[model samples]
Target: MRKLLLPSLIIVAASLLVIRIFYLQVIDDSFKLKSDNNAIKIKYDYPERGYIYDRNGKLLVANQASYDIMVIPRELKNTDTLEFCQLLNITKEDFIKKIEKAKIYSPRLPSVFLPQLNKSEFAAFQEKIRKFEGFYFQKRSLRDYEVDSGANIFGFITQVNEKLVAKNPYYNSGDLIGRQGVEESYEDILRGIKGVKYIQKDKYNREIGSFKEGRYDTIAVQGEDINLTIDAELQKYGEELMINKRGGIVAIEPKTGEILALVTAPSYDPSILVGRQRSKNYTKLYHDSIAKPLYDRGLLAEYPPGSPFKILTGLVALQEGVVNEQTTFMCNHGFAYAPGRFQRCHCGGGPRDLHVGIYKSCNAYFSNVYLRTIGKYKSSPYAVDVWSNHIKSFGLGQFMGYDLPTGKKGKAPTSKTYKKMYPDWGWSGKTIISNAIGQGEVLMTPIQLANMMAAVANEGYYYTPHIIKKIEGKKIDTKFTTKHVTTIDKKYFKPMISGLFDVYNLGTAAGLRVEGIDICGKTGTAENFAKIDGKRVQLKDHSIFVAFAPKDNPKIAIAILVENGGFGATIAGPIASLMIEKYLRKKITRTDLETRILNTSLQAQYAKLGGLSEDIKLELRKNDSILKSKTVIPKIKIDSTKEN
Candidate 1:
């Protein structure tokens, strides 16, 4: 019986093994796929990157022919290393490093040896292409900017590193990936589908023919061209107006919520980051700590919205039913909350109504209103949470989820925010009363401020501000089409609109009004601060302005913020008015204003951040050394000398 059991077990095991082998050989093709991979050499057909056009169909970004030297690590023979290095303008050390990197990526796969070669370089290298057995040219398209502006908007593309390749199976050793801005946001769409050609290789690794008669081969699909919502003329005009200044301007269409112009000052031409010079230019831009040209202040800089924030305050006050349109607050030059703790204001001391408050940017009226809103609830935390919710409903404290790949969630203080800060002290709305005037812990980006103005323009509703107007054979994201309604009721926005209109008629921006354009705008001068010598020193104010035009059927809503610019009306207001006029009328009526802004340069004011001047800074260093020498005690003291 034991002998019979042993034979039976052996037979059953053999039968199971045979069944498994049959399944692997016939039913499953995974092993066959792996075998084919070893015998097949893949040739990637990289498609052209998508064309980018402005809303008016003007070409903004096009592609130019670029060549990359690709290498298969195991395919190299007794090649002339010196000739290869000299031809490619690379060192022997660089060749070794690149070769090792490619091997680490995949010995059997192709990797970039030298990328982004011009036509001349490619022609020079093509002559000796047959000399190098492992090396070959992989033609690809490089971004050729049609316009010189909007580098921050278009962003740049670069070769995928080992880290990116390991994470995404779609990319290999030498693929391009978008870095920042719109390019990154729509990378999958813009990159298109890469096709592959598989050639059969013999035991000697010589190409024979197509694997399975090109059954697995696919044709390359060119990237889909896209239209941005940005108006090319408006974008250029806005960039021109912001020359030599550090600021951001965001203009949105009030009717559709399309981004008309996104301008960040101290920006570089997008072409600088295109070819071989891209890496060098990018490094230079990255190292520029001051007047950071690479930094997109339009979406990243979180400045105190200044008086532009008062718009949200008023809206929240109305929504909370803390104040009515006719609500009046007394302003004795400012709101004096606790004894001698006064928030100073420049709005002429008088009994000011809501209409009077907004145009004049009265600190007193809004502070009182803010305090009243907080007073409505029993607990300060409860009150603040309510206020924060109303503020966030306008998308102040969070990311607006714009199509751009980069941004900052400018802070709107909540109860939890204050609870952590004022843990021991009793607090109320007046405790953080600076918020009422767009001060305090309140901060907002240029885009957010523009969106807020758009809400006001649409009378309590705004579409999500987006950059895409149309994508080829595809619909823009539904979020861009969807309307975002504010917490404030529609009826409450009328009086606020009247106040904003009065701003152009009888307010701070009276000197910068456009003819035939009934503008509704607010000027803001948020106090700037810097740390000098371990002390928080107050710098010049950040000039801010937000506006919408036509007053009845609003077309454009815009926001501008200039760092170290003194008063809002002086720099930001004039720029905003000119932008509105440019977008709406397509011609500048105010030539003098345009000339003045073009001529004006704030480089001197920006330099003052380090010291009064180079001479003054030198003098201070000199004095600092002198003071240190005077305070120093003698190393060899008299007492020690006497004892010796």
Candidate 2:
């Protein structure tokens, strides 16, 4: 009986082992993958990234072939490390460090050792790469920019970190991911699927043939092409005008909410962020604290909307039924709210109504209207809450949910915020009267201001501003197409629109009007202040302008801000006028205006600050030198604006 039991147990164990082997070989792919890893070499075929096109079908971004030296830590065998390092123009210590990092990621998987080798370096390395056991050249495409402008719009790509690799299963070590702007926002659509190939290796680790007669291979799928709303000529022109200045400009189509041009001054060429020199150039840009070239002022800079905000105050007052088009207020140089306190106005004191207030930018009139709007409610907090809600309805004091990856939600002081500010004392419209003039706690980004103008141009509503007009063979998100109505009634906008029209014809922006176009605009001078050595010091006011052209059916709505530029009419208004003329007329007959703007330099004002680093000073000096160079303004023809 004991002999029979032993034999049966042996047979049972043998049958179990056979079943396990069959299950692993036929059903469970995990074990098969492990076995394949030992005997086969896997290679990735990276797909070409999508092409980026401007609204007129002009190519903005394309791709160029580049090579990366990839390494598999576990596959490494005895080889001449010195020769490999010499061929790749890297130190032995760098090679070891990269290999250690690759092992930490996954000893069996591959990682990039050295990336973005130029054509010459790639040609030299291709002949000698076979001498290395674990290393091979992987082909990838790098961004090829067609135009020098729009660096803030089309962001660059860099390798994914360990955290990203762990979070996203789709990514492996040394994978490139978009860093910012549209590239990051549309990464999934722009970065197509990577294909894989498995090649069987013999006992000597030499590739014999396909692992399973090419059954495991996949074909790479190219990324989808995307069409941006940006106009190439308009974008280039805006960037050129913004040279030697520091600030932002954003333009949107009033009807469709499609962004036309987004410019941030002191921007570097897009090509500088590509290839082997990317890290070095990026470090330089990052450390220039004053210039902040990497910072996208259009989307991220929060500033006082200045007089451009008074337009909203007028709209809100009309909506609240506190004031009408015929309502008038008298300004004795300013509005006297308290016994001795007064909010000053730049407009010459006179009897001013809503139209005159907006056109002339009367602080006293707007303040009076704001007090009436707030006084309509019984409780001060409740009144401020109502006013806050009315302002929020226009998409202020909130993130506008733009397609770009980064933005700033500029502040709009609510009742709760005021309560925090004035904890003991109760507050009222008089306490927060600065808000009536777009000062005090009211802050907005350049894009938000542009969108607000778009809403006003549309008369009552606005489509959320967006950069992507269309993706190839796919529909855009419904959120961008949906209409967002403001708190103001449609009828109330006409008076306000008329007021804006008069601004170009007879008000603060009158001197900056364009020829043969009905340009409606508001000029603003926001007082700039900074804390230096623990003392609040006032600097030159920021020049601000918001406008829409051809008043009846507006095509473009724009917002411009120039730091340290005193009086909105001086700098921002003329720039906005030129931009409008360029977009509508397609040719600037006002070359003198364009030349003057191009030649103007604000570097001296930027240098006045005492806390800047030496690196920043050097960079500023470099830019100053470039700006001082005499460069002729070309005769930009109307044909440049033609559709491709």
Candidate 3:
């Protein structure tokens, strides 16, 4: 019995050993095959980005062919570092750092040595690439701005970081994405579909052939093209007008809701961000503290709307029955707020009606009207809340839902806001007296101001303001084309518009009015908080103007601002009038106007003691030089085709 038991035990142990060996060699083959596939095989693919164009079918942003030097650190062996660095025109340290970063990203995936390579760089690298392993050139497209019209509007594309990649499946490491403006708002539509290819590679990592003879390949579909509402000619003219100024301008067709011109001063050339030199140029722009050329002041700048807010107040007053078309208010050069502190009126007369109030931009008239309107709400609990809601209905103190991205919702203090600060006090009509004349925590962008003018011109109705008119050969739905109707009676706007017309024909803007055209306009001198010294002092006021042409049947509406430009009537009003004249009449009698704008220098202004900074002075000089030098003919040109 003992002998039989020993023999049985040995047989059982032998069977178990055979089973364990089979599991190790055969059952685990799938995991080993996957590991091998990941180490030796490589595939790289880039999807083509979308295109951008202007209203007239002109290309605004398009994809151009460029190369990136991709590296796989694990596969790299005994590479010619000196030759590679020399070919890329980069230092050895940079090359080593970039390679180390690539290794950190992953060994199987490709990483960038240089992005947005020009034709010359690509050519040089292509020649010496045969001697390198685990490194190759990947072809893709980078955005190219065509006419340099809208820097902020077009935005910029840059490499995707690890955080962005982890959140989104559509993007991988080393992908370019839109950072701001229209590019960001329409990223899904503008970014073309990405395609992939599966290819069989040998042990040496050489592409043998397609995995399934191109059967499992995705066909690359180009991105949808976007057509803007901007007119290149008008945009160029507006940008020219805003050259020396530190402000913004937004002009649009009231009927079509098309943006004719949108200008933000102190902007950089779009061409600088195109090729391999992008990083260097971007770094310089990023560090520039004074001019801040990269800042999109047009959409981002939030300043007091000043007298422009009176237009809305007028509409509200007329709608709420607080004031009629013939109502009048007495002005004494300054409004008595409490005692010595007065909100000054630009008007200098004793008494003025609604029409004269608009022409004179009477602060007291609007303030009285606002007080009366808020007084009706005194009996209600939701007085402040309801009043805030009424203001927001006009698209103030909130986002307007425009096509452009990252727009500011200018501050409009609510009842709750005031309540939080002074919950125990009586918050009555006089509590928010300053907001009536467009001051005291009220702020808005020039685009919003222009849209308000458009709404006024349309008699309390306007289409939503937009930069892109059409996209992908399909016109954007006219749903945004719907008109925004203000609560004011349509008849009330006629008299207000008449006063605005008188402003151009006989009042403040008379000096800048176009001949043979009925232009309606209003001006504002917005006082800023910035001071010249330790003592609180009034610096030059920001010149501001809002206007529309052919008052009976308005075609264009615009808003212009000139930072630290003194008075609105003299500086900004004329600029807007000139722009309107050029658009409506097709020419200007004052050819000197262009010359004056181009040649004007801020050196004398800055030279004043404690007036401006040295960097600002230098930047002004540089800007003036660039503008003056940008004439038809160059002073010197080296012609490679012709002999010296």
Candidate 4:
């Protein structure tokens, strides 16, 4: 009996010991995980944005060191609110509101107090930051505009909004985002991978050491570099040349499709938009009505292409067999369409052939050619459709699909668009006559116009226009390398080339061609509407010029538009010549011509915005005292010519 009792007690003790071991091994894991969570903090370290460089390896956009005053609201205590407001140059009420916003973002996490403070402001803040327990200074990178220009293309970087974070899991709330232009287009490539550090904190909530002595810490990866196609020197020169003028200049290398210079006049210094003053500076620039500096005229502004459309018309007629190089029409100052309604011509009476018509830019010749070109088709509708299709193939009446963001596809009417407006029972060639002269419904961006020149220069094909040359040592999409074929044959471009060459030699543009340089150019003067005193007033003309130099083997294709500039040959033509010479020859000899065009006229400044009716202006100016307290406005000199 005694032996049996001792064996039973030993078995029970062993069973109890086994149960205790299982409790420690299995059930205690949750407690250990909680302890670890309390000891460590997870932090994301941001990577630097990629640098921007021009074709010559010159830096254009880069990063500058910026400091942000950050605060963890939950940890803040005994903070001197008045003193902090004074240091940040804000009122106490303003300071309090900012804190509320920061708290809504995250109470435990650090929120930015003062963003992008300069050296002087940061140095002062650093001295007082130690006294505030919950607040600290964090180092960040802000966009630095080196050239003080190219605001529209280079664009600006700002904090990622909640909407962006929700759409992309890769972005954090505080991360910087590209707002426009190349910056926005290449956001994924330019933004580098972020890193994380697993840190251990002491009881005081201060970092004691990295978790596992930095074993799990990830190193930050740098962003991919961006190589631009622009030439910094040429771009700056072009911008200065177009000062006080509302227009744009786009210059592209004909062979490679590299944009050498993209200039939009009345542009503000990009550097002014960085840091805490971004909102204030943006307001000042945004309210300027005369220049509309934010408007990107080079790629965004669409205008009736004017006489430059003659180049396309000439090509279409020759290709369609409606006209030949020797086809002649008599132009006796104008063509009498109806008894009193005549299409006038600046070129007087002459028996002008197709080549001569292109040289003199005779409207009568194209009006006849357009009718013949379309009438040559089996049916009138078929001719109009086919002719419009050919225009579309040249990248006109459609988005050029440039690498830049937000482009306008200047209106090219599909038969559907016209069908809605015309209620057409019977369509004829005369109905679309305005399109033959590059006016009426035909409109296009400067970039698209330049690309059209590229197609002509290539004889029948062209690459898509692009701003980014390479990213992170690799070139942009392979599609940009694909040659877009036009409907015209390569041989057909030969005779058309002669007509364009004659344009610079014996045409309207003949007077402006540089000696010893074979320049092919087309000039245009377009009419636009402006509002003044509750009435639609005929504003100054828009002068436009499109050209390619060394026409036989073209090197550059350029388009220049000067708003309110009179006569494309005088104002816009010289600017186009200067830009072409600056890019190809690397020098400008026409200083007087540049000065005369830059300081020509300012009539358009007084013209009211089209959106505002005349009655509103009267009400706004009712008080003589209010009208007299005018700010010193900048003088604008405009050239009244059709620049497309």
Considering every candidate listed, which one attains the maximal lDDT?
2
Q: What digit string (tens of lDDT, one per residue) describes model 2 on residues 1-644?
A: 98899999999999999999988888754445445366778777889999999999999999999888888888898879899888778898988898898888777778888888878999998898778888888898889999988989999988888899889987877678888988999999999898988888898877899877887789889888999999999999998888778889999999999999999887888898899988877887776555678889899888878888899899989999999999999988867898888677779989999999989899889899999989999546879888988888888999998799999999888988988999999988888888888888888999999999999999989998899988999999999999999888899999998999999888988778777899888988876556555555556667899999879899999999988777888888889999988988888977878888988877666666435446555666654322211111111111100000
lDDT of 1 by residue, 188-283 (tens): 989988998878889888899987788778988988999999999999888888876778999999889899999887777788787787887777
Find the number of clashing residue pairs for candidate 3: 0
The pairs that clash in candidate 2 are none
lDDT scores of the candidates, listed in order: 0.82, 0.84, 0.72, 0.76
lDDT of 4 at 63: 87
> What lDDT does model 4 reach?
0.76
Q: Model 1 lDDT vs. the true structure?
A: 0.82
How displaced is residue 183 in candidate 1, in Å? Answer: 1.3
Better of 1 and 4 by lDDT: 1
Question: Ten residues in a row with the worst lDDT in model 4?
Answer: 623-632
> Which predicted model would earn the best TM-score?
2
TM-score of 3: 0.86
User: Of models 2 and 3, which has the larger lDDT?
Assistant: 2
Query: Which of the two candidates, 3 or 4, achieves a greater lDDT against the reference?
Result: 4
Q: Which stretches of candidate 2 lie over 4 Å from their true place?
A: 1-24, 27-31, 34-36, 75-78, 609-644
**lDDT by residue (tens digit), candidate 3, 479-539:** 6778777666688888888888887766666677666788889888776543443534444
